[model samples]
Target chain A: MTGIVVLAVAVMAALGFGLYRRTRDGRFAADAAAGDGPTTPTTPTTPAWTAILAAHPDGELGERATLVQFSSAFCAPCRATRVVLGGIAEREAGVVHLEVDAEKHLALVRALDVRRTPTTLILDAAGRELGRAAGAPRRDQVLAALPA
Target chain B: MTGIDPRGPRFTAAVTALIVAAALVIPSANLSALLMFIQGAFFAVGAYAGVQYTPTAVLFRRVIRPRLSPPTELEDPRPPQFAQGIGLVFAVVSVTGYAIGPVLLGQVAAGLAFAAALLNAVFGFCLGCELYLRGLRLKERLA
Candidate 1:
């Protein structure tokens, strides 16, 4: 009887663990889908956009284009993105790259609707939006997004 | 950081995941048992790690302790020892269930772990702390 009970417990634990993994996987997929929507609201009074642009007083607009990546120090993916972005920028003199520490600027995140880390916003010389990429854009994808 | 309960969130998530995983693993379930076992292992590790570390104790001494709360007759920040004792028991039982074989009783432990993890992650709450506090109260009663 004792042996039977032990067997029962092990089987149950295994079953419970399986359910949890499924739930977690499902939630991750859902979060990915929701990322595209501009659901998050910005702070009413803060002019975060203006501040961001003003902080870069050099006004050095890129000839290839500009890529700004918002990231946090502890985020692993952000580190990888930084390296990739840097390599891309080095190759294309026109492709200027910049990074902003997200933790220091919550206002900017809300204004830009930046829900996830490693969010890249691309802009042309005149500060017009060319395109944007969330998560880690593939090497080819990053290059492809560059303006000719 | 010394006293702060890291175990609460980790413990809850690991167990919750274990229970949900185990329940889905029916007789026909192929990969279910494997998944649950991994989660169960993580729970065991988390439970053991939580009690061993004393983040709150260190943090209090370094920061909060130095800046005293202006003499308001502060109660002890720690929860009862029994809470952790119960948690330890649960961890051992849950791991044992995983070891022997699959059974419904194992699910009960997994379910408890899952609930604990959810509360910790979503609300920043700690069940371990509650258990410890209960243990302390019991001790006081006995005294």
Candidate 2:
């Protein structure tokens, strides 16, 4: 009787957690303090956009939008995210996809407050952080997150 | 880095979930301890020797891979390997709990491991991988 109860509870908890993650994962959420939000006027002396571009000499900002992905060596979702973001960048005009190795860029990763692998930041042409997603985002979700 | 068929780890997780579930459902403590011990050995081998050497990986390579078409993509093995280490930790606690006293400790440990394995098997959600990444982030923040 005890064993069955434990098994049932474990199954329920796993299912619930999986369902919750599925609903939220890869869905971009706009930053409340970003864009035109009223927040503290104390902007960082070193902006994240400049720091990111400075770190990657080869990376150029897109005319319309940029998708910046932070990936580690061992993350499986990172591989899938690369494919999705790459395909979108290829198909869309003036959209750039840039990948950063989180392991190598610990300083930048800390600066950006990236908590996990395959985190993508959607930046407008001016390099402002419009929003960010914490997992492997779907292609349609990425499209929807972009500014018109 | 050498890439592996991503399905290999998932297959391993499925087997692990079944074994853990069995361990949970079995009424006898001795049998449950033995089952967890076996699973822990597998985890140890996978974690230390590399994921490719695990028994289920062997099964996947010899029996499963040949039957299915080639995978569209391959994945890094490090994350799944780390997951094995995490599984080994829980399995150790579970076996100790069942083999000694306090069967509840064993049950809870095994249950958590089972849930993690099920998540990986069913949803492809790698809890160990997430933990590993989070650890790195925490380390970076501290540094």
Candidate 3:
């Protein structure tokens, strides 16, 4: 029956999306994790910041960690991200949250391969690009991702 | 740009799911056509004027939300509006598909819309919202 088919689709979609929903929110993964290369954590003295910023221009570097968040006006997650990052910046003295308008910085977005609103590019004080999280990150997740 | 109750859209999706499911399961061409029109009209109103104006939203405000405990958080309206736009496209295409030739086209479109709404209703997943973001990414990549 068509109804049976439709209901079956509903059940499958529910299961598929339920699993995706469980994992997709606020989870951070390193860029190198995409490849076979083991993720080597950025050191305090890395010289990669200048080159990274030259390639992907946005905001000034922070003192400790710079959270460069690419946000679109209409996206909902961006709002939540703004709050999360702002709170992090507030509580932590050296950290900074830089919110970029993705609409205005299409070239930068393309350059960074920012595929979603609220895609955060975590940079060290030296301006080196670190890992990125594609959704609105939770407080603990953001805190954990920051440079020690 | 106020935040919606979040549950409001879910309620709307639930209603949409039922209507679309009924339309799909029933074999009457005339009945299906009528159902599509009604559903399409709801989508159009929600798409253009925002979901706050829809009949379902009224139900949420007047009856449902009161019985329920207050939401711990509120969500932006734009993503859901984007979803309504996606719903509008499918509903229109389904109507047009039925008008032209193959009834199956209409059924498939309706089924897709129904499935998407059902996903949001039950699982709190926003497929349309996700697609909108992906489409933006694709456009950025292409340019």
Candidate with the greatest lDDT versus the true structure: 2
| Tens-digit lDDT track of model 2 for B1-143 | 88999899999999999999999999999999999999999999999999999999999999999999999889889989989999999999999999996999999999999999999999999988777667877876687
Model 3 regions lying over 4 Å from their true place: A33-58, B137-143
- On the 0 to 100 scale, the lDDT of residue B112 in model 1 is 61
DockQ of each: 0.03, 0.64, 0.49
Best by DockQ: 2
Q: What residue pairs are clashing in model 3?
A: none
lDDT of 3 by residue, B71-108 (tens): 98898877788798899898887777666647777888
Tally clashing residue pairs in candidate 2: 0
lDDT string for model 2 (A73-142, tens) is 7688999999999999999999999999988887788778888888999877777777889889999999
TM-score of each: 0.41, 0.90, 0.85
List where candidate 2 sits over 4 angstroms from the true fold: A36-47, A54-58, B140-143
lDDT of 1 by residue, B1-143 (tens): 23333333333444454454443444322233444555545444434544333343344346555575443222222322323344445545555555564544454564565455454444333445433323433454477
Local error of candidate 2 at A88, Å? 2.0
Indicate the worst ten consecutive residues by lDDT in candidate 3 chain B. B96-105
Better of 1 and 3 by lDDT: 3
Q: Rate the local accuracy (lDDT) of all candidates.
A: 0.50, 0.88, 0.77
